[model samples]
Target: MQNNLPTRKIIHVDMDAFYASVAQMDNPELKGKAIAVGGAGARGVISAASYEARMFGVRSAMSGRLAIKLCPELIFVKTNFERYKEISKQIRNIFLDYTDLVEPLSLDEAYLDVTVNKIGMPSATLLAQTIRTRIYNEVGLTASAGISINKFIAKIASDYNKPNGQKTVNPEDVLQFLEELDIKKFYGVGKVTAEKMYQRGIFTGKDLKLKSLDYLNEHFGKSGYFYYQVVRGIHNSEVKPNRIRKSLAAERTFSENLSSEIFMLEKLEQIAEEVSKRLNKNKVAGKTITLKIKYSDFTLQTRSKTIPYFVSEKAIILETAKDLLYQDTLSNSVRLLGISLSNLNTDSKNTKTEEKKVINVQLKFEF
Candidate 1:
């Protein structure tokens, strides 16, 4: 039960219902209503749902028709990516004021390493509060935060008191806090994994800790070792500021399902243009082009072509997607079409793994 590990102050900040909240913030008329940000058609999917919508069992990714059935008065607002990005940049600037080690998980959430900050602040708790207050005052958004010794615990703690709240787990309490955590609450554990763990009687972190490393690996494959290490408070992953972009994509859902390739050609063209524009904005091109098709029955199929040369042009993208669309016979009527490019032109550096410098946690160390 006694071991040493380097303690780093990590804070996870998460925005509450970001897309839906932004929609509500921009439109005074949408305030205090059950709002969902996405299309309001039968084929439309909810990108985000306001807290009011959650009360009626509506959630993000639910079909618009299903959401309306759940909440009869649900309001659907179109997504505004430009507005969201603007606000997100503002929030990221606020983070840069304290520390340069900011790793954005998405436009709405990020991880900040403040073990050694610009302000030389000793209290992560106070720093988290100050950041949240500034967000509400300056950008007019509420954010929740979790402060802990590492990213794994910090991320889970942030959700404990959500919607403009913060939680701090001191170094001395890390072991006990993690041991008592539910297996499902572990950072990387999903519904399917949780069910698998339950079948093995691993209901909590403490239960998971009892299994031998060999036994865990034998059962869960590579992730079994991750579970064993994290439950014992041994996670050492850093908050990477320059996380590599794996892919860039754009997609659209049709109001009515199209049954023929001729009907889908124009939609594919528009989607390819969007993809090309995004690639140009990022100043990156890819050698691989993928065409995604979602049928009326909700099954998905992808066709990809890897060219000898990277491309970032609307004409090239459209032509490639058109070729893929007609590559095979129609399986079913298509409802959604998407285009994506991968194998981006970006540097990939191999970070050498550093052995953990374990030292016993002093009784009075900062988070």
Candidate 2:
């Protein structure tokens, strides 16, 4: 067993109605109103809904028609992947200023392991608050941060005072805070699971604490093991940056310059296929896609777009790539082409309750 328990300074940063908030930040008309980003036409699904829309029952994955029913006055906008990626990169750079242990959950949220920080602050809570303030003052955005001994509790506390606020949970308050927590508040406990636990008379963290590992496993599968530890306010997961692209694409360079639109399309197709296959295997989606191309003249241009949400599918990426490639006039014969994905949220922690372990993983990308 590892005897050295480093005093970890973990902070969970959650954006308030992230997607909707972004929409509002740009358009004053959408302020204090119900707005959603995603499909607005028939067969469209809501990628995100504002808190106002949420009050009327709008939610992610819900069909456009249903979301409209939930909020009749809801406004819908198409996803702007490119702009969001740039913002994500900018905010991530801010985190890097403090520590390399920044793990981005998505374009809007993250878990920061500032146990050993760049600011040299003694308390993780202060770091979290500082980060939140910076995000607001610097980025023209508001974020809620949670601070705790571990990722599990820190995530929960962040949601405590959401929408431009933050809170801290020291080791001393873990037990009391979790004891009376509703079972539904635990991470991964959706309506069905919460109902099941309720039927079994499991209402609070203390009640869940009484369940044997076997019992929780039988009922909740792999997540059961996590739930067991979470009720005790323990989570040992590490913070990892979302830098790794699920797909790797390599482009071939022509020894002799080739000047043809067909040639560029074909090359992009090959690279896109390779990326698509990798994405399928990993079962992950990327919100940002970057295309790097080199000309025979030794000139390089990089075009990138951050999708409204993550997409791991091959067809969508190829389509997007084709559009981007076409947008380039292709004055010089293409010598090299490369593609990469970023703003990846592999473990998108579901919306938090009060005392649950929200799991989100970030892969590292240095380019």
Candidate 3:
């Protein structure tokens, strides 16, 4: 059974509007300007929208047309996923130096369990502070962090202070802090859910906690259990640094949509090369091959086929993706390509991919 137990020290690190921030870092002119990624023309979906654009109600996943309506001056740029991935690797390396418990939520955010670490640090709060400072100093970008006793609380804490800010919560003050927070701010509680809670007089953690477990479970099937412990500042989600490559996958968005078959094949070759590199790094292979295609209209579809045994070689992955690509007729222009690997073995391949795993983040803190 899972519980919302607290960690001795847990921290959440989230980048500030990650993609937009990266753009700002590379070009100073983009800073404080309304910016977005993708085309402003028809059928363009935003990959990221800057804070300046957000102020005008623009957002990621919003169509480029609507974003333009909100902020006419929005500057659209092409996606440079490889560059972002490289930066993510650099940041991950820095986190690993401090502790092995680093669980990446995505390319831009991660949870860490640093209760007992390499440096024998005495305070998790101090460690979280140092990590935030180091990322800014070393990476030349701003990051925000949240430190608390559990993943639930820590994740929320990190968001309270954004764009290079850090927040800490002491155990003794947990209830009071939670009581004052708007119920809508509770983890996983969105607008519609909050409205329901408000009608039921569930306006705060205290209100939420007052409901019987049976009642909450009755109303919210599985997620109710999540709410129970969170109100009390307890969570038990592990900071799993080592997740065996369940599915070997690689993805890249083009600088622009590929309109010609020659350009499409070139992009596929690049992606295949990347998949091959990951396979060699992981030292694992799979019989199953999957090809993911994203069209210029932002509609995505995938195709997959499995082969016998596992493989971790570059040549094999490319051959498989190449074979998969032409298996279907091409009608629409493509904007993104992805390859994945699964079913790996340690003994039959390179020894590099097999290693002990480290946790990324822990939950719960003294302050």
Candidate 4:
């Protein structure tokens, strides 16, 4: 395992149930109630759910109908993007006071590199506490923070305490903290990937670290290398302030599943048009066209074609999507359809170079 590694003070700040909290903050009646932010219509999906709602298994991206089935007392509230954006701006301003090297993952979450911050604070733990305190005092909403030597660990540490709390993983404790972490808790490992790891007997970081690099590659493909390196604490990605958008997409979930391809053509056309519109609005075009299919049983599959040139026209997008749709047989009745564009002209030219086998870093500072 790689012991010597570069260290930088990184903090991941995530607002606790941002959307649902905002609704509760704005409306007195919603306080301490099980609420989800979305429409209660047949085709509606929950954007966010309060902790109370979560106790009943209501979660974001879940259908509103299912959410109601899970919690009969769940209140559905309409989304207020204007209010969210306004509050986000306020929170961002607080981050700016400490560091300009802020990488926003979303409106509610961000990674802050405070190795060399504006306030010249020596302790990242103190910085996180102060930042969270200010956010609560000024914005009237609580946030959670995770502080560590790198962004990867910081992001995971932030979720340890949860809902208005903070966790700091000192450099000395980084390895042990990661080793003890559940495989599912690793940042990039989702439900599907976690299941795959479990099938391979990789239940934790310690189990993953025991595997050879070639063994991981053979089993997990490109991601296997990432798993091997991260288990050894070798993440070297710097906190980039101007994180570029890699892809753009639009999707729709139907109230009723459509079985035939003929019934899907119109939906595909609409989706393609939406994708084209978003690409144009972003002033970018992509060479890759991907069609995402989500079946009624919640199984998802994607088909993609990368052309020689980037195209943002709806006609071109729709034609490509049509080709992909006909390329495969229907797996099951489709409930959702989506179109996404990648390999965009705006993609970064810089590539990540491999880190050395071992490198020394100053890790004596306070976490």
- For this target, which candidate reaches the highest TM-score against the unseen true structure? 4
> What lDDT tens digits, residue by residue, belong to model 3 across residues 133-239?
88889987888898876677788889898878988876666677777778888878988889988988999888998999888888877978888767866666777
Of 1 and 4, the candidate ahead on lDDT is 4
**Which stretches of model 4 miss by more than 4 angstroms?**
1-3, 260-263, 349-364
In model 1, residue pairs whose N, Cα or C atoms come closer than 3 Å (at least 3 residues apart or on different chains), thus clashing, are 4-359
- By summed lDDT, the worst window of 10 consecutive residues in model 1 runs over 347-356
Give a tens-digit lDDT track for model 2, residues 296-363.
Answer: 77689988877787787767787788778877687687767887776666533422434635443232
Model 2 scores a TM of 0.66
> lDDT scores for all predictions?
0.89, 0.77, 0.79, 0.91
Q: Which pairs of residues clash in candidate 2, taking residues 3 or more apart in a chain or in different chains?
A: 81-306, 187-356, 241-362, 242-362, 242-363, 243-363, 243-364, 243-365, 244-363, 244-364
**lDDT for position 315 in model 1:** 96
Provide TM-scores for the models.
0.88, 0.66, 0.69, 0.91
* Candidate 1, 1-367: lDDT as tens digits: 2446757889999999999988888888988899999848877888999999999999988999999999999999998999999999999999999999999999999999988789988889899999999999998889999999889999999999977899998877888998899999998999999999999999988999999999999999999889888898888888888887878999988888999788799889889889999999999888899999999999999999999887999999999999999899879999899999988776352234456444433444455
| Model 1: per-residue Cα lDDT at residue 186 | 94
